[model samples]
Target: DASGVEAVALALVINSGVTLVKTIPLRRFEDAVRFGIGLSPVFTVFQVDDQITSSPHIAGPTGDTRLMPDPSQTVGLVASPGWALAPVDQLDQDGEPYPGCPRTFARRMLERLAGHGLELRGCYEIEFFLGHRAAPGPDEADPTPAHTGPAYGAIALADVEPFATALIRAFEEQGTGVMQFHPEYSTGQLELSVPHSVGIAAADTDLVVRHTIRAVARNHGYAVSFAPVVFAERVGNGNHLHLSLWNRNGRNLFQGGRGPEGMTREAEAFTAGVLAALPALTAITAPSVPSYQRLQPHRWSGPWACWGRENREAALRFVTGMVGSRPDAANLEVKSMDPAANPYLALGAIVAAGIDGLERELSLPDPVQDDPASIPARKRRSLGIRQLPASLTEAIAELEKSPMLREAMGDVLFDSFLATRRAERDVFEGQDPEDVVRAHRWRY
Candidate 1:
């Protein structure tokens, strides 16, 4: 084992966005990798709560698959000694890549884009809340924020300096790039973003980085929740996605072009496609019940299905970067998504929508300069800005209408994903917002 690693975690992300993992001892790693560890296909439709939902394509106890860890991207965990993490690909008994595999779906999307001489560089910006360990008792009080300083204040950074500092070291030592990490707008909530990676690695990084955070936090006697909403009243966390398009020759397509904010026709078309598909995309990116609480208007969560330059309220916020840095730094920020999403499936869906835009040569509408909701109704309608799906139910309905997204994910994946979503909706039906938020508090 490299670095005296004792075990390796074979991690897989299912349609429900939960990371289901199996670990193997170092001595057995070769056998596990070559022959794969058996896993049931029913996991494809597991709920966030671990309840299984059935799909016509893949369900029940009749099917099996193998989880083969990717050795190329395996890494020793600096935060958790004697361990390593490797993302896995699910292959059916026939040794064929399974249609229900989210990771494989993401790779296929990237391959599709590569065929057009294009590529994506993307990363996840994760926000999470930290809570102190709860005392054991029947009358145990509520878990308190690990830090009491004002939100986003310097005092907040100082309060959690020890844990935060360890977090930084863990990331650096593990070879994970840390672009920025700091206090966020909610009490005990912190946000960190890593440098973008090309292809499925970005999605892989999302899982490993989150694992590193949880391990370091436990060592510091704190609990971590990447859930959309930790409490009913508090502002929820965001898993904002930052992405950019580039060509094989290393040119940034988002800048130095004739379209809006120097976007090339391809870039503009891609943006338009994403904007038009926000309603449908939510079924993948913001799949949780409490996810709606974070997607509300005025939360700066970008509930409006529109775009603007550096506008946080816009679903797609275009960043031109600082003067003279446009070529290297330009990217788009998707503010509506949260950590509850499966990044692989989310990224693939986003790319699929963008591909549709490019194929149709779609044009982006005029950017929303103000909050779309605050604008006069007539003006908002004229600008073509509409609020995205308000609930998981509505988002699922929109997804049902999207043939493009369904085709992108294929029938097996598409059917199983919907099955899980519908199961979640039915399970949480009639639950109050506070109850819903609490149920999802530590799931991710």
Candidate 2:
């Protein structure tokens, strides 16, 4: 019951593209519960240099702090000693919605969807790498990979059994369901599939899952990296989102008996909207410079803006259900995402884009039955398939010019997000590749 616990950690995802945590003594939990914790609004615009600034004039040293906790999200930390996670709501002093808040954006999107008689159900398929930190000393060697894999070989699972077993147990204790875990193709890489939940809960569960994995890895004397590409030469980690839409009547709106590939009209429009918006969506879903390193063609990171049935190489992969689940199990897997992205923003942008498609009644294009990159360049263009933004700078440019995304995220959020991303890109653009990886490898 953690009866002896002396503190609770309140975590918030800030505009800096990272989670900022504040620990309050247990005795003060009541005070927080009563009046809420004071937090500087400047945190929303903080850059890696601790500067509170953003483009289009968002620099602030005058706003008051507001941190309201969601009591329902409070959960015990089974992996970290004497710790607990309390997700907080960020707002302004006047109790108005903070345009910089990702969760606020997500809630607004959900509300918009509800207005259309639809709901979102989804989960994150997380992949990460475990490495061993060398002994602390001036002469310490570089961190060593935990396992060398033969690409999902049985031996790979046995190699990390102790850590994997503990991680699964901790996830269960923390109320985060684990559907499956396996070794990925890359060295030291492992993938975990979590059970899906609806809307905001799904994002909440993703935060818990990532936190649990990092905590459990630390407990085992290892370091875990959710960076998109841990090594330049190997397959990178991805945080793929599997999403489905449901109607108010409890029916899977994505299922259609007459639609192509068994996708309902609603699902088709939703997917078409997502595909159309993929170029700009890259700024949010694959938000880091290192993310672009992992999004290249032939790498299976959804390098092309196309959809295919069970195609890993396409940005959107439509998965068909098994016997027990049947049509209800069908969902769209967005493969161009990674863990560096804030789940709230990523999922929110996706829903908003899909809704835009639905509102406009957009039509789905023909599914790419083969590898998108394999097709000739001229032919690819004929099929309306285009390469995703290949760099963070390029992606941010698309995002900045995207009226749909700007409308979905609001001007304040959209501008601030771009400023933050631009700041990151400016820092990494001319830097050495190793230096860049070192800077972000452990942060995400």
Candidate 3:
């Protein structure tokens, strides 16, 4: 509640797969903070077409509203006008918990892990593109790339120095620790790595990171796109997750000399569960039609559901500890995620899968040492390695059949989530490839 604050933006992650924001002027923000803000329950079932209301929740003749407060999230918009994020909780008319709430699901998952004397520690490694807005064209596609050169070239980083500087400073002010920033393989593409945190804080930091980057880029007169693919022929963007587990006494549970690749027994079990559920998890982790375009072989987008040591092509890569960092630096990287995913939901599902493995004492498969694609097809099949869902339709079908994931997410959220994804599929199923990419280019 800074005196200079002019507005508070209440943010909610809705079923449409984007953060929905509602702004309140400074004068009214105090009241909103005290009394909470009113929101329609229909938001949980909102489709691309406002007129097409087909969800079971909407089948009833009557509708209801709820009032939930703006929880305390990272506050940093000092570089922009006086603005900050106001995160809200969705509830029922009687003020009961809303089943489709992503944050609630994440919290519950964290609690479940805690019950086993373990905690989740991780961060999202975000990749995105920066460019000018597209000039109006017959096809209405996004703008052309802002720069072109070798990936990680010094010239590419120098070209975006001003915007990058502002973004880093803004993130610092908001309490997000910037570990590294560099130009990526695609033209105008960049990647940012933030320091990891425990449990819910990691997702909260992801939100702050996205908001800070977008706001600072806007101030520099540049548009940032976190879409899976900004251009059809270029390398696509991915929001890879670096995950690990820890004990309450501050010990890294993923490190040990007894298991495969120097991993601990706990780490092996957790990784096995996530691999077992990779096909179903894809629908939630890469929730957009364009996301499938990025998950192909040889692009390092985790095309196959197999775990390997330092193998980028596998869905889960077991990262080794750095020379100085030792056991503390070890973690698993989940590469199938994209920016379009709701951080809370993606993380929640991941933790649930890991816990399932831990509880059931699941065993880890042998690690893939060579490039999985180069391995003979017969050998790959015998090794139990399988390709992930190549299309959104296939991913959705896999999710629908997963009894374990459905039970984890609960009936209310699972049904609503499926309905929303189906609606998205209906809208983009037959559209041109470039057109589909354009439609999702800036929304994330």
Tens digit of per-residue lDDT, candidate 3, span 182-282 = 89998889999999988887787777778778888889888888888888766899999998888877878777658888777888888889999999999
lDDT measured at residue 100 in model 3 versus the true structure, 0 to 100: 75
From the highest TM-score down, the ranking of the candidates is 1, 2, 3
Candidate 1 lDDT, 1-444, residue by residue in tens:
387799999998887778878999988888878889999999998999889989889767887999988888788889999999999888988899989999999889889888878999989999999878467454444579977658778899998999999999999988987999899888789999899888888899999988999999999988898999887867888888899999988999999999999999889998899988999999898998889988988888889899999888888999899999999899989888988999999999999999889888899988777878789888788878888998999999999999999999999999999999999999885799877876677678
**Any residue pairs clashing in model 2, and if so which?**
none
Clash list (residue pairs), candidate 1: none
Clash pairs detected, candidate 3: none
TM-score per candidate: 0.97, 0.95, 0.94
* Regions of model 1 farther than 4 Å from truth: 135-141
Ranking by lDDT: 1, 2, 3
lDDT of 1 at 12: 87
**Cα misplacement distance, residue 240 of candidate 2 (Å):** 1.0
lDDT for each residue of candidate 2 in 373-411, tens digit (9 for 90 to 100): 789999999999999999999998898888999999988
Q: Better model by TM-score, 1 or 3?
A: 1
- Ten residues in sequence with the least summed lDDT for candidate 2: 48-57
45: Cα error in model 1, Å: 1.2
